[model samples]
Target: MPDFADLRERMIRRQIELRGIADPRILEAFRAVPREAFVSASYAEAAYEDRPLPIEAGQTISQPYIVALMIEAAEIGRGDRVLEVGAGSGYAAAVMSRMADTVIGIERQHNLVQVARERLDRLDFSNVIIIEGDGTRGCPEEAPFDAILAAASGSHVPKPLVDQLAPGGRLVMPIGNPNWVQHLVKVTKAEDGRLQQSDLGEVRFVPLIGEEGWRDG
Candidate 1:
């Protein structure tokens, strides 16, 4: 059996911490969730690697470093409600649940939704709920999220997501073509409803598909 705990520790130290992800809460969250459980048994050995792995529904889990980067960028705090778009394997949501009061993960694929829900439940991550729906349309019923993280890349920041963010909320997502390199962006909604956006860096992600996003290919 692989020493998953040791592998996880090495992944954190080299892939995440060495890259400057210093939030204690974020670090602890990574430690709390078992990444191996999120992927299939065939890919379990690669779970702790610093790369994305294929999950069900033709989707990919975000790399651990990228996940941590987005979570850190959102600045999730205790008692905050977080929304995660493209919750592929529920891994990121599980990690965020450790820090946030509640987390809603939106996955468009039915199988992925089932997989995520099952994994989260089995692991006792009760604070996270995976819903099957279009990720471009943020969950308005549970709007005013303190932090929002979109794992997929879109041509633009969907307006519904911005509209759903609570004043003083932060959103981190990638913007650009899905087939090409994309820019990771952070959008902050000020208390007075003003929005400020800053570029995080370049990244590649699956297309954010839905009504407000790219049409199915």
Candidate 2:
């Protein structure tokens, strides 16, 4: 068996840390989660690699660097309640669970939701709750999230997600066409309920499908 722990540590330092993921808590979170557990059995060996890999139902897990970048952009705190859209294999949710008090992950596909929930539970990341639903709608019942992140891309930030943010919450997502380029954006809601948007960088993500998002094919 590969020394997954050692590989994870190396990935943190080489792929994550050196790439400018400066948050110590995020770094520690990256080290603790077992990436191999979230991937398919056939992809176990590529789990610690710096690149994204296929999961199920034509979905792909985000690369480790992109995950770190998005988390860092959101500026999650230990006491915050975070919401994750497009949970996929639940790897990002597991990592976020370590950096925040609680995390709610939403996925559209039932199969992906089942995979994410099962893997997260088996890994003992009890702080994360996976729900099968439309991610673009956000979780209104759990509204006022301290931080919100989306793993998929659309033409713009969904209005529903912005509405669900706490007064000072931060929302991070990739916005643009999934077939081509997308900008990773961070929107911070001020105390006055106004939004300040920043384009973090360019990224590529699967299409975010929902009512407020791209139409499902």
The digit string of per-residue lDDT tens for model 2 on 1-217 reads: 8999999999999998998877899999988899999999999999999899999888899999999999999999989999999999999999999989999999999999999988988889999999999999999998889999999998888999999999999999999997998999999999999999999988999999998889898
Question: Each candidate's lDDT (Cα)?
Answer: 0.95, 0.93
Best by TM-score: 1
* Model 1 lDDT per residue over 180-213, tens place: 9999999999999999999999999999999988
Worst 10 residues of 2 by lDDT: 15-24
TM-score of 2: 0.98
List pairs with backbone clashes in candidate 1. none
Off by over 4 Å in 2: none
Off by over 4 Å in 1: none
